[model samples]
Target chain A: MRRRSFFQVAGATVAASTLVLAGCKDTEVVQPTTTNVLNLGSNDAGVLNYAYLLEQLEAAFYQKVLDTPPADMPKEELALFTELRDHEVIHREYLKELLGANAIPTVEFDFTSLTLTTRAGVLAAARTFEDLGVAAYNGAGKLFTSKAFLVAAGKIASVEARHAAFIHDLAQAPAFTGVVETSGRYTGMATALTPLQVIEAAVKFFPFTVITSGLPTA
Target chain B: MNLFKIIAELEKVDPEVMDRLSHRRSALSALGDFSKKMALAAAPIAVGSAFNKAMGQNTLTDANGILNYALLLERLEYSFYDQALKAATLTGTLTGAARTAIETIRAHELAHVNLLTAALGSNAAPAPANGFDFGSAFATYPGFLTVAQALEDTGVRAYKGQAGNIPRTLNPTVGGAVVNLLTVALQIHSVEARHAAHIRYMRRGATAGAQSTIFPWINNADANGAPAVVYGAGNPVATFPAESNLAQGGISNLATGLGTTYTVEDVSAAFDEGLDNTTVTAIARATATF
Candidate 1:
């Protein structure tokens, strides 16, 4: 009897949201708004739809970086950036397919603020993108419906964090070259962000409509 | 969001559907309970590692093979997090958040273990219990930060390293289901990266480095008065490793219609400090040297 309640509490998935086929047809879905850059349709699918948006932003940003390598870029840095670029591409493509038939349209972007012409500019751009990427995942991980998806989010967000740290270390490495530092105890200022916050930052690069009415906040 | 409220609301919405989900959850949970119990039951009678030896040498075959390898890595991660969270004397809000996140990660790892075990079935050999050699390295508070950096960073690279194992194409050669899980796996890797960055930001010395550095070439930082320069030490960031130089020939190279001069090794080393798994030990030793 005790176990029954435990089972209900632990097993309760969000109403009928998850079991339904990719729920793009939820006409109740709010369109993208000025405030919300990514219009996740609410619930778990909305959250993934949110992720799909960010992946598209990142993939596009890095795509340009590769397309226009700046002058004086080092063989090493450019190569690393390029490798990172490929990853963003893969992420963008992978996410596009993940939504199945119900995926959001691939919104266009303008990362014009990023100066891909110089080494420092490129690294700085890399830093911002990496930071945003990690934060986007951080905010979204809790919203995931499946244990498999949550575990998978852990695997990828850490890579984004690594990218952020590598850039941090490169620009101002801690005593140890690769060692990442902690400013406060938990690092809330860095890692724990909401989708709203992430989208705010993301819009600086990609000015898309933000519509997240249906996404379950919890 | 409060997990309890979420559960309550979910139960209220559809008791019938919730009941089925509960059954599924219990079934999975039972499997988890049984596997753990069996592991414990066998520990006394059988040599712990004898099971792995019987599974034969690590078979790096299809997606199943790749995930098992990842499960092994995640087990190590889950253990490290469990011990670190237990040992840390985190202060105030940071402590609460860290504890929650540590449990979240631990839970996530366990779920991954369960899911992968289901996928592999009898093929899933309980991985040998490998002891992490952190020893007294992460004992001190500052030392904890440093070690956290290394572990999180390594975790990131390791995921990137393992991604190649999952078939990337989905032509019926890979199927949509494998692709879906792989995408989820990638998402999880990103989430862990965020955790690492959070730790790394906190570990930095308060006074060190330029507090305010402008992001040059960003017109808005100057034009709109958005500080081109990011200011001062941030709140705790994740403590944040790598692999071979296999990604030397990336789309970036293809963008220019020429290959990059950088080798895969160099890029791997950039994020993954200890591909050899020696960086942690080396850093520990180097701490005394400098």
Candidate 2:
């Protein structure tokens, strides 16, 4: 029995090390080598990396819009987007700082899927990023083993929710009724998505694949 | 049989077993005595009952405390909006967008109250001792929006303060139920933030000078005519800092880390700070006037 248990432990350790090696290789290679996998590491690190990637996507999106805003965009609307851009940049930089050594390299996104030349289009895209961000943080909250990380994530989560509300209101003015769970046991609660669900939804904007299997499901 | 050994074995399966047992130390001691008095088969039954009792009490003492506090805030918000919507004075002055937003927010608040009450079950906090009176807030549109923003922003901070307290476990069966509490709290927390942003949007549109300062997200400790306590720090200012706080995770100057020329207000608006339970309760009670 003791020998069998030792073998089982050794087998698990080997498998874990293989996974770590694969993750490291994925990060080391810049070019898409058949599959450019972005492995969000395990446990709290995985959660932080996942958040950092989302912030990167958001910061990049807002920066693009601010760089070349639509002609029809009003001054007030432009100002709002500037704040959104600043917040996303701050979030991106802060998260990158948090991840430090565990942080994935700065991602090069493919924003071709989005329509950035028109006012309505910009609002629509902003709505998508903001809503997805809120749901991502909400879903990822329980996966954190560290309370400080959880608290820090919570701080950003609400801010993202606020951004979602503002963007949603702009996209659908006079009738924007904040993001609520329309159908569920918690009907009035906010919507939360699993990391897998979030990645699936957000994969279109990514130039490469994001492997979230390393992340904690619970 | 050794109770400690049994617990140790259970802990291997359910890591949160210690958390569940710690809350009911007296029950654990009683469990040991009861186990010795019973047959081996009966010991398992007694052990199960003791654990259930422990978990139930812990839920009441910890999780329920947070939920009940949330319930009170929800009730307060629901009542505030309910009263505003019912009042012709405020409704008369509201724009189509403002009225629609308030109605939607009021419904969401009511739904939140229902959700928390269901989560708390019989342990739900009773209705506020004193009825809510928005005072002159009901007399005008701006007044209503100001109070609404304060309430919603406070609700967001209050929920964030309690996120760490929500329990989770590795036990697949019971873990789902306990973690669901955390999930529900988070879901509600964001909704409160959404409401806060919407309220701020309406307020900014109504007032001219409020644009630069009053965006959907909070700007520094600028209370914007609501209660000052809503934006100020809690009892332990270090743990629960004011809304203008810029530092996070022991990094003193966030601007230095971000390598940006962002002002104090910009840095402050980047992150929302939490208000501890004591501060949140005092603010809520002060606003709960008839």
Candidate 3:
């Protein structure tokens, strides 16, 4: 959903507070309502922003789910969601600090496609998001010039993969194949998508368009 | 005269020549002597064989060495799955989704082997298909899952360790190739983590009450269900802590208030740590016995 739409649902006061705590004014980070494109810069900055955007989307997603938790959600599952949300927020803020002024403004996400009221729907959507995060980090790591950044991405990618596996099992008990398996492309490795491919899949849940040409291909 | 200056003088006499042919022969002779001195004392003939091996494997200095190490891990992982899939008892032991996951993981591992082998080309390490004794590593499905978790976790750590070996820039062609290989390594690395997580989940499924305590993410080397003993105590102290490490980029998640309400354990569960080459190789060697 658009930022305004999310603010409307979550209450503007809370949104403003969150923005301030995240280290930026809403006006400084959020773009004009008419401008729908978010440009992820080039090189290391672009990749860090790429990661930051994904983490923001994940953190927001988990927060929204927790805020309006389905009544049927089990306690264990609720705890899992809380942990996932916390991890993503940690990752998002870490990238923001690493990127400093170069970081992309907080991009708006649209989870309208998901049916958040049901356990099955939430888990399934989480599986998709988690898997996408893994794939995106996998592909984006090589684009970074700094070994420090590559290793950092590696650290995060593995955790994302774990989350993907857990969520996949939760979505379909005993169906753990999807998270670890990929088609026999790229020499039988798991899915690793270029920025364009990742952004294409991710944009469906984003309210605004993500122009990924600024991101590296290799 | 300095070697380059001599070569430059030689070039004046013969523009097509890059360096002196006699000098190249002497360099090869010196390399042979160095290899002879480094050869296995028990088997003098092994020196010739070692010398015959690709130069890339001998020089573990840069990206080539990283690619070689990656190939070794892939071969190990691929053979593990390949043998497990072929085991006669596996058919009756693991059914349904578990079987499917195993098959899928096998395919990915084999793919990684092929991809890394292709990337390494002549420098590819010897495949240990004949040497890998799956029976010793894991005889039953549950045993298989335990070892699978170990190997996959090791693979993830190994790749992360080697990632720093990739040079940021080189000749465009070589640099591009390194980047492609590094990307491939990253892709396979996360897949390995997924494999570890799923294997942990499957183990939890078999054990009735493990879910509440068991986590998919790596904790202290001894945490969760990680078989630290199988890895042996010979592992360097630095590498052991690395597997279950809770810190990253000098920032401790233990400190509160970045943006989460999770406790210390949850914070630790949120990140996987990287293993250095010595530790990863030791673990791989211990497991490779079977």
Q: Considering every candidate listed, which one attains the maximal DockQ?
A: 2
Candidate 1: list runs displaced more than 4 Å: A1-38, A172-190, B1-290
Please give the distance, in angstroms, between residue B124's alpha carbon in candidate 2 and its true position after superposition: 1.5
Which pairs of residues have clashing backbones in candidate 3? Answer: A1-A109, A1-A110, B133-B290
Q: Least lDDT summed over 10 consecutive residues: which range in candidate 2 chain B?
A: B52-61
Worst 10 residues of 3 chain B by lDDT: B14-23
TM-score of chain B of 1: 0.46
Task: Estimate the TM-score of every prediction.
Answer: 0.44, 0.79, 0.73
lDDT of 2: 0.72
Model 2: CAPRI class = acceptable
Query: Residue A170 error for model 2, in Å?
Result: 2.1
Off by over 4 Å in 3: A1-37, A173-185, A209-213, B1-59, B86-92, B134-136, B168-179, B207-212, B220-222, B229-241, B252-254, B257-262
Per-residue lDDT of B1-290 in model 3, one digit per residue for the tens?
A: 01122222222222212211211333223223322333222222221222222211112457667777887888888888888877875667777777787887777788777776777667777776566765565566766777787888777777766665665443223313433656666777887887878887777775323455556775445434445743232233322234444444323333243443455655556666656666677677777773
Tens-place lDDT digits, model 2, residues B196-260:
98888777774423544667888889998899899998755655778888766434556654556
DockQ for all models: 0.08, 0.24, 0.19
The worst-scoring run of ten residues by lDDT in candidate 1 chain A lies at A175-184
Global lDDT of each model? Answer: 0.45, 0.72, 0.64
